[model samples]
Target: MSNATVRPLGYDLELISTIYISHSKNSVLPLLVASLMVNDISIIAIDGDHIDDVRTMIDIIQHLGAHCIQEKNRLIVDARDLQNFDANIPECSSTRYSLLLLGALSARLGKSKVALPGGCDLNRPFDFHITCLEAFGNEITVDNRSITCIQKHSPKTEFSLPYPSVGTTLQAIFSTVIGDSRLAIIIRNTALEPEIDDVIAFLNKAGAKVFRDDSNITVIPVGRGSLSAVSHEPIHDRIEASSYAFAAVATRKVVLLKNCPVKLMTQALTILEQLKCIFYIQSEHDILVDGRSIEESDPISVVTQPYPGFPTDLQPILAALCCTLKAVSHIRDEVMPHRTGYVKELEKIGALISSDGNKITIMGFESLSNAVTVNVSAPDLRGGMAIIILAISNGCDIRIESFNQILRGYSRIISNAHILGGAISHEHP
Candidate 1:
């Protein structure tokens, strides 16, 4: 291994291992397995560690239990996790964008649904499920911290969101009508992250009514019908891909991300612009990044909110970038509680970051001097990965714990580091 110390970040990192699920693909693996079991699908995760073996596993998923278990669970099903789509619940197959399920479930199933919103609090700016349901003539009443939607006269026949809520977007589309009918949904001041578009496109593939204007989306509802099974690969995840790219920037090293789509990373690219990081987007899949000349940028401001704004997922990496800069920077996480607030780990990396509710004020420093072991618990995925970047950049042995959350986002991060020219990996003893 390189001279760099093996500093892992996260509160629970010490206990977990580089899990070799061998037989099954992870990401949303657990969720898929759960879905398979509940639906009585004939799918099983084996103990094999190769692509060919996993393909066989998918063959089982292709034809199995016909029933789908729509029970509620706090599952993180982003599009990046699946090797292939779920055939039984193709509508629900792609978990990453599963928030779209809220609409269809409510309409045909009579609006009875429960599911956890993923990503940090910043991810959910507005709840779209309620908006579309009310517009569709569904009597949506708040039930003590829970929302209940009851269809009353097939809804108002018109739906829109003050903001484009994925949950709301789905609700509006499904509530169209039993037959062909025209409907409109207003998604004003709404941001459309590429991932949201993934689900919209999927619905369109299934022949759902969907039309979007500058800020509003007009989705012609596709009434209940056994839509033909559609097959299409999910777009490569730019968020996960860019995190590694940001890692290269943190260490001031050159890391080329192949199989990555550059168009989706415009927002992160813009912020990196402020840092003066040189990014060469050669092809659709290739992104080469070289950092500034070890020079610190002036103090800057980063507010992490919903899409179109700086992503909350990138806040941790940006915070790591802030630490390298010898200036004051502000990262305000306006969504979750104490999310970017976890800048305390930055203190371990030798940066000054303070938490005040949803806002974080970071003071850039020249360098965080050498330290024995920098131990910190990761509050979430990006935050956790950032600690790894901080360790690599500052030459510190950072121990990150609570990797369970981090793994939900990044797949085989250590492998990524090993493949790239950044840090070395070591199993915790």
Candidate 2:
């Protein structure tokens, strides 16, 4: 857990008006790790709203001898003095992003011992990352606790991922950037997430040659000591923006999401339209979602896919919204099979939800009969958001525990909810 303070949500929270929210910290954290490959200072200007959530990654990099300073929205990272390559500490195990360090560390220091990562219980294995590193001529040993990798003299020139995993794709690119300048590494079937493109743009700006063609990515290795300092601002978080949109629709409120990336949210917007929610794209970056008149629609059937498709991250949020409708909804998450852990949590608060493997069946009710004050716990990040949305939409006097999990992905959630006329507060002991 981080040193940042967390306060649970009080009872009977309701979002009754419009609210404006900032971007998330998801896209910028990877860039921060990429900055470590540079021998010079790299400046990253992140949205201040969720900057506190980035402290875990900064602390992990600092443990590896990188000097990182956070000043409001701006982060200054100096990796010229990085001396530690072993990332077996607790911080590395806190989030799965630490797995990216295997490539960065091995490329810079020749070897890395990274503990197995821990995050949401999404049933995602680390074999994809291991396969990518092993293809790069890195001898890897995995045990119950950690994975150790040592680079060999001759690295493979090409590899292909069995699945389009975003983490494995990033590991392959980072490991290829600074080793064997004569080799041009090719990675096929890579994830086409916008964040991957953001990382590629950042790397290209910092003197790395990385290109993408459809599902394949090519990284032309630059010689050691080639990367230079660069400043980058990551694109807005599409998942965060969609979360707010779902919240608006669930609570029947009008919310104007500022600095939202509307283009990246094609599938989500399409689904919202199906739900009869109104959207006014104020500009390329702003959207006004009016959900005050949401009507009963047909049953919704959604399948989670990669970029440009229905996102698995938003499945929980959508599931929560479906619980309030008069029709049944089915959500299948092919990406993360075990993502339905929150179904039980939602059921605790009078929601009719059931899970069978990766598929979730939501028997929507016309209205919730809230006769008692119920307390529920957040199972994970996205799942927690789902529970909160359901609680507010029903106007149930529910107390939510483990809200810190929700804070991991969302910034200033309670304050933003309050701004939208939600009667929410910290749960005092």
Candidate 2 error regions (>4 Å): 1-24, 51-53, 366-371, 419-421, 427-429
TM-score of each predicted structure versus truth: 0.69, 0.92
**270-342 per-residue lDDT for model 1 (tens digits):** 8667777777776887776665333475666977767667776677787787777778888777644457545
Model 2 over residues 270-289: C-alpha lDDT tens digits? Answer: 97888777788879888888
lDDT of 2 at 131: 80
User: Evaluated with lDDT, which candidate comes out highest?
Assistant: 2
Q: CA lDDT of each candidate? A: 0.52, 0.82
Superposition error at 387 for model 1 (Å): 2.1
Off by over 4 Å in 1: 1-100, 115-128, 139-150, 165-167, 174-189, 292-294, 334-338, 365-371, 419-429
